[model samples]
Target: MAHHWYRNTTSGNSLQESLDELTQSQQITPQLALQALLQFDKAVNSLLAQRVRNRVNFRQSYGSLTTYRIGDNVWTFVPNDVEFSKVTALIKVDKVKIAACDDENTGSNAKE
Candidate 1:
């Protein structure tokens, strides 16, 4: 439950909008709404970790590693002449950015 990437995006916006409505109607206090949203974030993180089964692997061949970065335990790579494959399908691109995160390092179980 460490990363709430969707909290500021589409999925989280709906909950925030609903909370705003409830707050304006006086059915829930602002503090309560905030707590609810925070709980929603945690719930979403756990649910995705536990329920999502889809996975994709990419294999790339590049002339040289253009750039690489590691921050917050996530690795980002920008390579030139990249090719990505999932199963038997292959895609080629001039330049691509790849970002990877290890769930174990983040204290989450992505395969559970």
Candidate 2:
């Protein structure tokens, strides 16, 4: 027989149902039941990590930002002009142009 990996369940009802059935049939002791619950938690966390990794990889390899032309409303963070100031404000303004910022040109001096 081949080993089959279970699909990630969002509702968690599948694991809960299995645990309930096991308890009803008196198949698992209290310690074993606790272990099974812990294992289920680990599996769910692993699935979440895998999903985040997949999204990051996809974006890095094949993601592009749409161009924003002038007059398009956007929110921007404005730094305080005064020296030694720590205040910042979010202001709404019309975009002048759209510029691409890839890994090579995303430093502090890069224009947005």
Candidate 3:
């Protein structure tokens, strides 16, 4: 969805600039200049295809899901009670720091 400018390698100027130069000098017709610009764009796009392929391979090798720590004041939805007028329980969880996990002591199924 992004537009890019194609430059002519001979003069190191954009296709638009080349067209303007030709028009000013009356060297080539406007229709021929337009055709040359289109051909230059096609050649540039063909060269860009290889670079895009490399980027796809790079993304596939390194892309991964990242985990983030949940904040203590995270919100949770609770259903409203039928009989109670105001029914909302906002539980505040306390953060606890624990040492390394042990199979028997920590009640974890981790193998030694």
Clashes of 3: 0
In the range 1-112, model 3's lDDT, one tens digit per residue, is 1123235355336567868898889999898887887677666667654565421111112222232232322222222221212234333222212122122223442110
Identify the leading candidate in terms of TM-score: 1
The TM-scores, one per candidate, come to 0.61, 0.35, 0.37
Per-residue lDDT, model 1, residue 7, is 77
| Residue 2 error, candidate 1, Å | 5.1
Clashes by residue pair, model 1: none
Model 3 global lDDT (CA atoms, 0 to 1): 0.42
Worst 10 residues of 2 by lDDT: 54-63
lDDT per model vs. reference: 0.73, 0.42, 0.42
**Highest lDDT among the candidates is held by which one?**
1
Ordering by lDDT: 1, 3, 2
Cα misplacement distance, residue 76 of candidate 1 (Å):
3.1
Model 3 earns a TM-score of 0.37
